[model samples]
Target: MTLDFSVVTGAWQSLLLGTVGTLFLAFSGMALAMIIGVLGVVILRMQLRLPSLLVNAFIEIVRNTPFLVQIFFLFFALPLAGIRLNPTLTAILALGVNGGAYAIEIIRGGVESVPKGQTEAGLALGLHKHEVFRLIVLKPALRAIYPSLSSQFILLTLTTAICTSISAYELTSVGQRIEAETFRSFEVYFTLTGIYLVISLVTMWLLAAIGRRAFSYPQR
Candidate 1:
């Protein structure tokens, strides 16, 4: 049987909308993950007993558990506890929280790679500890770990498809709707596979450009 591209063409509008939603979710989730990563690293640096333990526990739980289980808990369990979240919000939150766990370790490793001498010098200049961390340590550390962090963020974007499990209505969800309506499973899903591949490829290209601009430095 010959493959028909028209089916995909017909549903392209919905698919495009879904793709936009996926991008939005991915960006928002990554932003939140970065925030969590930075804050988690700070908490670890503080060396406080209780807060450090809490952050570590959070990291362990998120990194060790299945992503689907985490999404399920946030989407379903929270509602029972008098905390209701819209599906898209739930998707973003779940992805952010899960990605943040891995991001913490990645960012922390980056921070650790920074020379202690540099941090000391920053402090010796009468800068506050936070200022030293921000200006002297964090930027260089992020540059070192940019590749790993970008890869993690891409993985988070791909995981957006799993949001369909909770009816969050992203790309996969839109494709499913098209398939159900058209009764053309092969055509619909094949198109979806291609779209996801394109999204991933384009995301990587954009990230590489951003890294070059933000992290690359000229030699003196």
Candidate 2:
């Protein structure tokens, strides 16, 4: 059978829009995940029995469940509780919540890897506990875990494709529409694969740049 990619040409604008939508969801979700990760680590470190247990429970639930189910619940079930969210909002919230679960563990491991002496030293310098964590421990810990965090974010980006299952606007959803209109499943999917590869590569490059700017310190 002869292959024709002509169908994609007609839908280029839609595909571009979808790419933008995917990027918006991924980046917004990532921001929320980072916030959750940092806050969750801080709460866990506080050693408050109840808060720690709650945070741990949240992490366990998110990590153990499939993301598709999580998104479905947010999109379908939350409305029953009188909490309605548009598809876009639900997708972002789901991605953030799911990514945050893993982020909590990844960040906690990095925090634990820091030498206790550093925390003590910061305390000795009259730094508040919050100051000590923010100024002394957090930066180095994040630098050490940058690679792992970067990988997780990349995975999170690809996971946006699954958001389409909830009728959320994203690259995969656009591809589905194009495929329906053109009846060219192979061509549509092949194009999507290429687009996704480009997005992933670009994301990796951007993350590498951010890491260098944020974590690089001059060696003495």
Candidate 3:
């Protein structure tokens, strides 16, 4: 059968709307994840043993489970237990929690990569532990993990398609809707794949640029 561009062309507005939703969900989720990750990393690195154990348990649970199951539990099961989140909120929260676990590992690795000598040097200079971590460690650690972090964000963006499973009307959902309405499965899905690919590539480039600008001093 000859390929039809008509179905794709016809769904332009719907696709654009879906793209906006996808971007919103992905970036918002990443932002929330970043906040949780920073706090979790600090907690995990605490001198106290209990804090480390609690943080590790949180990371282990989130990293071990499938994100889809997590989303289902948050969206479906929570409501049954009286915590009713709307679809978009559920998607954001699920993605944030899942991504935050992964970010914790990345951020922790970055933290550990900083030289022991640097911490000692900072201490000798009379810098407090928190001051040393904030000024000497965190920025360099972020620089060390910059590539990994950017890649993770990109992956998170693509994973936002899973929101469609919970009926969040993201890009994938738009494609599904178009296919249902037009009965042009191949055309609709092919267009979707290309659209998502373009979106992901662009996001990667944007993140790379941001990392370059933000982490420039670390290279010196």
Candidate 4:
């Protein structure tokens, strides 16, 4: 069969909007994940028995479960408790929770890698406990884990395509609609693969730039 990419030409606007939607979901989710990751680490470090255990439990539960099942549970189950989030919100929340679980472990490893002497030095300098963590530990720990964290974020970006399964307005959902209308599955999916590659590459470039700027320091 002859390939005809022209079938998707008429849907360019829809595709563009979908791309924007995907980016929005990915970045927003990423922000939430970072918040959760950092806070989880702090809670774990606090060494409080109950809170630490709860944080560990959350991390374990999320990491052990399938993301699709988690998303479905949020979308379909929460309403039973009178907490109904729309599809877009559900997708973002699901992505954040899933990504956060992994982020906690990744970040915790970095935090643990930090020298205990650094924390003690910060305290000797009369810094508050929170300030010490922030100034002495958090920055270096983040730098150590930035590569792994960025990779996870890139994966999170691709995972946005799965949000289409929940009727979220993203590139994959738009492509599926176009494919249904034009009956050109190969061409549609082929274009989508190309677009996703472009997105991932662009994301990598941005992450690299951010890392350089944020973590720039004289090398030992």
Best by TM-score: 2
Q: What tens-digit string does per-residue lDDT give for candidate 4 at 143-187?
A: 999999999999999999989989999999999999999999999
Residue 83 of candidate 2: its Cα lDDT? Answer: 95
List per-prediction Cα lDDT, in the order shown.
Answer: 0.93, 0.94, 0.91, 0.94
Scored against the true structure, residue 85 in model 4 reaches a CA lDDT of: 87
Candidate 2 local lDDT, 1-220, one digit each (tens):
7788999978899999999999999999989999999999999999999999999999999999999999998888899999988899999999999999999999999999999999999999999999999999998999999999999998999999999999999999999998988899999999999999999999899999999998999879
- Candidate 4 backbone collisions, by pair: none
Lowest summed lDDT window (length 10), candidate 4: 3-12
List where candidate 2 sits over 4 angstroms from the true fold.
none
Q: Under the 3 Å rule for N, CA and C atoms, how many clashes does model 1 have?
A: 0
Clashes of each: 0, 0, 0, 0
| TM-score, candidate number 3 | 0.93
Q: What is the lDDT of residue 134 in candidate 4?
A: 90
Stretches of model 3 off by over 4 angstroms after superposition: 218-220
Question: RMSD, each candidate, Å?
Answer: 1.1, 0.9, 1.7, 1.3
In the range 1-220, model 3's lDDT, one tens digit per residue, is 8888898897799899999999999999999998888999889788679988888898999989988889988998887899888899999999999989999999999999999999999999999999999999999999999899888898899999988889996999999988888888999988889998999889888988898898887545
Task: State the lDDT at 192 in candidate 2.
Answer: 98
lDDT string, candidate 1, 156-183, tens digits:
9899999999999789999988888878
Q: What TM-score number comes out for model 4?
A: 0.97
Report the lDDT of model 4 for residue 158.
95
Better of 3 and 4 by lDDT: 4
